[model samples]
Target: MFNKILVANRGEIALRVIRAAREMGVKSVAVHSTADSDAMHVRMADESVCIGPPSSQQSYLSIPAIIAACEITGAEAIHPGYGFLSENAGFVQVIEDHGLTFIGPTAEHIRIMGDKITAKDTMKKLGVPCVPGSEGGVATLDEAKKLGAEIGYPVIIKATAGGGGKGMKVAQTAKDMERAFQTARAEGKSNFGNDEVYIEKYLTTPRHIEIQVFGDGKGRAVHLGERDCSLQRRHQKVFEEAPGPAISAEERARIGKVCADAMADISYIGAGTIEFLYENGEFYFIEMNTRLQVEHPVTEGIFGVDLVREQIRVASGLPMEFTQENLKINGHAIEVRLNAEKLPNFRPSPGRISQYHAPGGLGVRMDSALYDGYSIPPYYDSLIGKLIVHGRDRPEALARLGRALGELIIDGVDTTIPLFRALLEEEAVQTGAYNIHWLEHWLETNLGEA
Candidate 1:
């Protein structure tokens, strides 16, 4: 076990790591920017250091400043909680080069899986299912048209280098393929710094399902199960739950086994998520998140496991204490992300928090850094907190979540609470018949009425 570890992020996740480290009897050092001088994570950690100014490029994302903090604190490892440098392959290599452990996957695994195109190729080679697409980057307009025709109409042109929902476009007719191809290529070059593009068959109504896998360094891997993250907006997940109502036990077993095998084939280490788009009884690999996800607390609640602790144990050359047989998911769990945004249209609303109060009860859990008089800076993510609820069944969980959301109150900023409240009462959510587009369609119908 590491005597000390430095956390390379901010907000609730930073505080989350600090709490876990303290419970395990490990010292934690928190690195923060000038903007977060009095943040909760700084106050909770065993030690703190100010890296730089408020801008992410100069502060949270500053590689040299972070390494200096770790060296000065004599920390043996670093835990990047989600965003920022969590998935940066270069950062992982730098940490290893400095003889410091990065508490995630190896640099090789990160490099192979970081790029979207490379990841798709690797999954296909490993016998994992992937969406039918271009074999490599399309070199000419003729190649794009030929590929589009073979894949059928409504194909999505995507950047082979990077993604942000940018450098991507869809064409429904053959006549429009040439124009869309040029536009996507230009956008990709401007946004991602790469003009390479590929085409893939796009599903109009697909559900996003991801399997969570934990692996030790020596080729031992197991999956904790899957999460249904279909409730999203503009590719950003808002609500998530465990044990998707859409998948059966047989289907879950098949997908979980394949995901575990794929991770082992890549020599993947630590905790990671293998994402898939489930549409017609088949799972097609989309991408793999090489770090802990934002909605991981729901999985922890149902399984009664400490993922952070497990991550540390694996990085320290210790075998996982629990196996596939020992793991058992107890019940239904749901997490509603509370962000500083509007109800229907999620526009950022950042300001001071006047009255702040979180929900409480037997099955309710709140993870946040919110406090009275705290000002939400506009320079960072708009997330305010996460409300997770667990119950013996889906209905019970939904009801508990409704009650919890009703209890939550935050004044002086627009929030998504109204939207969640309306959603819990909708007939689709009550019967679990809603797909990925349900929320967006519902929003369009009741944009401002809620």
Candidate 2:
């Protein structure tokens, strides 16, 4: 076990990793930017260091600064709690070269899975179902048009190195193919520094379901069930639930086993998620997240396991304490992100939090770093906290989540709380009958009233 570890990010995820490390008797070092001087994670960590200013490029994303901090603190490992450099293959390789363990997958695995084109091809060879499209990246607009025509109308163009809905476009017909291809390529180059784009037969009304899998470096792996993340806006997940309400127990088991087997086949290490799009009782591979996901809490709630702790253990050369048989879904769990943004417009609201209160009760968990009078830095994501609730079933979980959301309060800033309050009452959301496009459609139709 590592004696000390540096948390290489900020906000609630940094705090989340700190708490988990404490539970395992590991000391934590928090690295923060000047903008986060009063951040809760820095206040709670065993030690803290100021790496740079507010800009992410000079601070949270600075590899040299983080490496220097680790050296100065004598930290044995780095736990990149999502975002920033969590999925950067170069960052992983550098940390290992510095003789520090990265509490994630190997650089080779990250490199392979980080690229959408290679990831899809690998999954296809592993017998995982994939959406029909071009065999590889569509390098030219002509090729994209040819592939789009062959795959039929309504295809999606995606960046090979894209995420969070960036570098993605949809073409409903051949006329739209040229613009979609150019836009996707330009955005991919701008955002991920790669102009590689791939085409896929877009599925309408598909549900975004992902399976959480963990593996030891030497081929042993297990699945902890699935999370329904269909509630999204602009390709970012807004709400998530465990034991996806749309799939049956048999379907869940089959998919989970397939993911575990695929991980073992590649000798994948640490924690990763295999994301899929589901429609008409069929699952198609979308992409793989090479690090812990933002919506991982829902999976932890149902499985009664600390995923961070497991990541640390496996990274420390320890085998998982349990097997697939030892894992069982206990109940339904739901999580809603409390972003500091306004509904309808969804504009970022960054300012001081005058009054902050979190709901508490049985099966309700709040992961946040906000406190009264803390200034929210606009340089980071709008997410201020996460509200998670567990219950015997989906209905019970929904009821609990509604009650908790009502009790939670944050002043001096616009938030998405009202949006969720309204969403909880929607018939489709309550019945779990919505698809990936449902949220966007709801926003267009109901944002005025909300």
Candidate 3:
């Protein structure tokens, strides 16, 4: 294995990589912006580099700065812990050009899966199920209107390069088509620099299911079951559970094989997630994430494996440690995001954390960067931590999650902990019958209940 690797992100994810590296006897180099000078990851890594100021463009997202950090630290590889340049194909190429290794999928794979239309087309060609809609980008209003009519009402317009619900809009009828199409295109341009939009049949009651697949660059690959990330707000996932409460063993095996086969066909490498919309016992491809996901802990909890360690081992040209037959789902696991945001309005709340206490117990894992005196800077994501619980079954997992949430405490800033606490009381959430739209509807009617 390489002696060192650089973690190219911040917050809890950066610390996740650093800890994984440390366990494998690999030193880590952490690159941070000025705002994160006193961050946990920076303090834990074997070496640290101040990349730039608080601005992400000049700091966390700066290619030259990250490359310079790797050079100065003699880091042999980079582990991009999601977001920023994690899916940027150009950054992967640059690392290779500098004679450094990138601990993820090949640039070609990233390029193919980065664009929505291309990925959908690719999945279709590979015999994976997909939502019915436009075959490609709709360049003009006339074409969009024509396609919308043909696809039927309640279709959604999405940017080819968009994510996080920024460039996605749904139109219930022809009259709403023009606005949604234009707004989706504009949001796409402003958020991702790609105005190209495509239409897809919107599954109103589908659940968000993502299959986690890992490959060894060669043609070998395996799937680690699925995570139900249906709970979200403004397109950001808040709660995720593994071995989807709604999926059966047969369905899990079938879809798991499909995703693993697809990754093997492309010779994918490292960690990747293929997201789908599941409804009425059928699965439709949505998009694929080419890096580790924020909710990966739930998967790890049930599988009894270290994904980060596996990612690093694969990146170092090692064969996979286990086969599909060797892997088994041990139990049910649930993960709830803990963000520093005020409820009701969901506004950002950043300030010093006067008091902090992490829940401790069996099957409970808290991955956070918060401290008693650390002042949360206003320059980054509102997420402060993730609380995960694993139990022998779904009911036990839910109970553990409730107990754990009750024990967590953070002062001086409003958080979303109460939101999750309220969710546990809902019959829909309790029975695992909640759909993608469940959280929004719940928030609308029971805004103050949490």
Candidate 4:
């Protein structure tokens, strides 16, 4: 096991990693920007270093500054807790080159899976089902238009190296395809440094389901089951639930086996997620997240597995402690992301929180670093915390989540808590009949209502 590790991110996830490391008797090093001088992660870790200014390019994403911090603190490994440089293959390689372990996947695996084109082709070779469309990236609008025609209308143009709903556009007609294709390409180039875009058929009313897979360095891998990320807004997940209510026992087995086989075939290591779009009882591979997802806590709540700890253990050359048989779902778990933003009209509301209170009690877990008078900087992600709840079943879980959300109190900034509270009361959400567009539609109908 590593004696010390450096966390290369910020916010609640950084704090979450610090607590996990403490439990295992591992010292933690936190590297923060000037803007995060008073951040909770810095205060909680055994050691903290200021990397750079508030801008991500000079700070959180700065490889040299982070590597220097690790060397100065004698940290043996770096844990990137989602976002920033977590999925950057080049960053992972740099860390290894500097004789530090990147507590995720090998650079080779990250390189292959980080790019959507290669990842999709690899999945196809492993017999994992993928959406029908282009075979590789389309360099020109003419190529995209041709592919769009072949795949029929209502196709999505996606960036090969994209995530977080960036560099993506949906085209419902040939005319829309021309503009969307160019726009997606431009955004991809600016956001990911890769303008490579691919075409995929868009499924109507699709449910977002992802299987969490973990592999030891020795080629052994197993899935922890599925999370229903169907509750999303603008193609980004806002809520997540484990043991997806939409999938059955047989479907779960099929999905799990397929994901494990795909990973084993590719020699994938560490923690990763294979996302799928489900519609009309069919699952189509969408993309793979090459790092730990932000919604991993809900899976931990249901499966009794500490995914971050497992990632560290795997990086340390330890074997997987359990097999597929040892993994079983216990109950329903739901996670609501508490973003520092407002609804109906999307905008960032960053300021010192006058009043801050987190929910507690049985089946409730809050992961955050916010407190009274803490200034939320708009220079980064709007997320402030994650509120996760577990129960015997979906209905029970929903009830618990509702109560937990009601108990949460945050002042001096507009939050999405009120929006989620309204969502919980929606009949469609209560019945598990909502799809990816449900939340956005609900917001439109109720955001401005009296």
On residues 136-171, what C-alpha lDDT tens digit does candidate 1 reach at each position?
Answer: 788899999999889998898887765446787888
List per-prediction Cα lDDT, in the order shown.
Answer: 0.88, 0.93, 0.94, 0.90
Model 3: per-residue Cα lDDT at residue 41: 92
Tens-digit lDDT string for candidate 3 (331-449): 99999999999989899999999999999899999999888898899998898999999999999999999999999999999999989998999998899998899898889888842
TM-score of each: 0.96, 0.99, 0.99, 0.97
- What lDDT tens digits, residue by residue, belong to model 4 across residues 1-450? 999999999999999999989998999999999999999999999999999999999999999999999999999999999989998889998998998999998888888888889988989998999999899989988888889899998999998888889999999999899889999999999987988899999887999999999988666789999999998877878889998888998999998999998787666778999999998888999888889999999999999989988888888878877799989899999999989887667688888999999999999999999988899998998999999999999999999999998899999999989878878878888888878878777766777521
Query: Cα deviation of 57 in candidate 2 (Å)?
Result: 0.4
What is candidate 2's TM-score against the reference? 0.99
How many clashing pairs per prediction, in order? 0, 0, 0, 1
**Candidate structures ordered by lDDT, highest first:** 3, 2, 4, 1
